[model samples]
Target: MIGAAWRRTLNDDRSYHAINLNEFSFTVPIYAYQVEGEGGLSLIWSRPNRD
Candidate 1:
């Protein structure tokens, strides 16, 4: 899971400032590894390990 946040200012009245974030979440790889092979350096990604 990943999150993004930003600060925003309202345009009404006294111009209130507020903190805002994404209402929806995105799924992304959490585990990654680098390997050296015949093709040179490579990157591999996998799911989180529970153990």
Candidate 2:
């Protein structure tokens, strides 16, 4: 695995979130969303778009 995260629940939406530690030693916020009909969660992490 590239990195690991500590799962947590949100108080507002009751959704899951975490802080991702990448292999490069950078920490980024990641969010977990439930997949439709799959009964699974997908982690999403992205950087701000600069145009």
Candidate 2: misplaced stretches above 4 Å? Answer: 19-21, 24-40, 48-51
What TM-score does structure 2 among the candidates reach?
Answer: 0.36
Taking the tens digit of each residue's C-alpha lDDT, what string does model 2 give over 1-51? 454656455665464545444444534433333322355666555653434
Off by over 4 Å in 1: 1-29, 48-51
Q: What is the lDDT of every predicted structure here?
A: 0.40, 0.48
Please report, as a residue range, the 10-residue window in candidate 1 with the lowest summed lDDT: 14-23
Clashes by residue pair, model 2? none
Cα RMSDs, all models: 16.2, 5.2
Please give each candidate's TM-score: 0.34, 0.36
Best by TM-score: 2
